[model samples]
Target: MVDTATNRVALVTGGSGGIGRVVSERLARDGMAVAVHYAGNEAGADEVVGGIASAGGRAMTVGGDVADERAMAEAFDAVEQGFGGVDVVVHTAGRMVLGPLTDFDLDDLDGMIRTNIRGTFVVDQLAARRVREGGAIVNFSSSVVKLAMPTYAPYAATKGAVDAVGLILARELRGRDITVNAVAPGPTATPLFLDGKDEETIGHLSKMAPLERLGTPDDVAEAVAFLAGPARWVNGQVVYANGGIV
Candidate 1:
């Protein structure tokens, strides 16, 4: 509800991490003032903000637990005060625990749910209330939901909820001139995705996509940029940026 008619601003949660970093950079490059959000990664967030400033783009670092309402609300207020208003919100901070549903530890499942499910709800609730008209809301999902791969049930379950959030919120925001969508990425080559995988497993996954390669952060960021900035007609959709893996 803040006045943001003159400049576009974007607040990207998890902006210090892999996919989020690239998305923040892409949005900044597109002429939007970017708020780089972090959770216990203020240093990383600062680095992102520095890079954006070096590139002559406007950006700042914001920190909060995505599932904590008070902290996130303060973060949102910081951005609105710093950059006029928030026009786009990208929730990319998520927890991924790959284990068979039956064998998964209850504590682990609870942790994942807190971060992935409740976190999404907290962010979306604030975004729906605060984002200026014509803004976009993007929640990150995984292609695993459709692939139905083994040992991915726990993680996919969380992303399934993400998909639902995007769909329902889009409809709920009717006539707000905003676009709500989810981006489902396939296996991407990032530090987070490559940390524990061996070369063989990486090779196998790379071949899963018809494009014969892993998806890049830029590949996913391009989809986000289009939706957040220019794709006004595209709304209430789950756009898969998985190189046709789904």
Candidate 2:
């Protein structure tokens, strides 16, 4: 068992699937007591927790909507009550709505704003107030903001807001020794990226990067783990984990 004094406790929002799942597992392997947060995916969260346990790591599942302040407050309380204190918070929970700027459905845009923009605000508010000194707050953004891909305008706008939040929060927490940063991943092989695309489209995107391949969940998780653990000097930055695609 890892020593409690040295083991940090992390609460990863949207920790049940895709890149979030890999991030939760990576943090656990790094000797953190991970609280895997999920929304309407208890089974997936359980599987994540079980995987961590099976690997001789400590983890638990927490459920709530990321945009709900009361629910997220209680979720934070649960993590603190369970593991003593929170040292890292990875806000990976988000929603994506693809459409052109002119014809984008207002309803879909509203939903994305609630989950991606409002959700980041709610989670960051708690993390800023609660996360221990020397801890880190890593928010998920997207390289699409830089790429300016078609049909991704709304989604990119949400991430642009996230990037702004991360940079501002880092300065806001100036004396706390905590680092706030955002990870903007590109063309990752997650359900969020692959769901509606055809094989031909996927293949084309996969080769857009200089690496000539789609980034895996683990690829992005490695960057998050770095920011969460050892990358202390890296703050208020958006580190794009997109294989030089930007």
True-vs-predicted CA distance for residue 15, candidate 1, Å: 0.2
Candidate 2 residue 51 C-alpha distance from true site, Å:
0.9
Model 2 weakest lDDT span, ten residues long = 1-10
Give per-residue CA lDDT, model 2, range 166-194, as digits (tens). 89999999999889999999989988788
TM-scores of the models, in the given order? 0.97, 0.97
Candidate number of the best lDDT: 2
lDDT of 1 at 84: 81
Tens digits of per-residue lDDT for model 1, 28-126: 988889999999999999999999999999999999999999999999999999998889999999988888877789898899999999999999999
lDDT of 1 at 88: 95
Error of 1 at 98 (Å): 1.0
Q: What is the lDDT of candidate 2?
A: 0.93
Residue pairs with clashing backbones, model 1? none
What CA RMSD would you report for each candidate? 1.9, 2.1
Candidate 1 root-mean-square deviation in Å: 1.9
Model 2 clash pairs? none
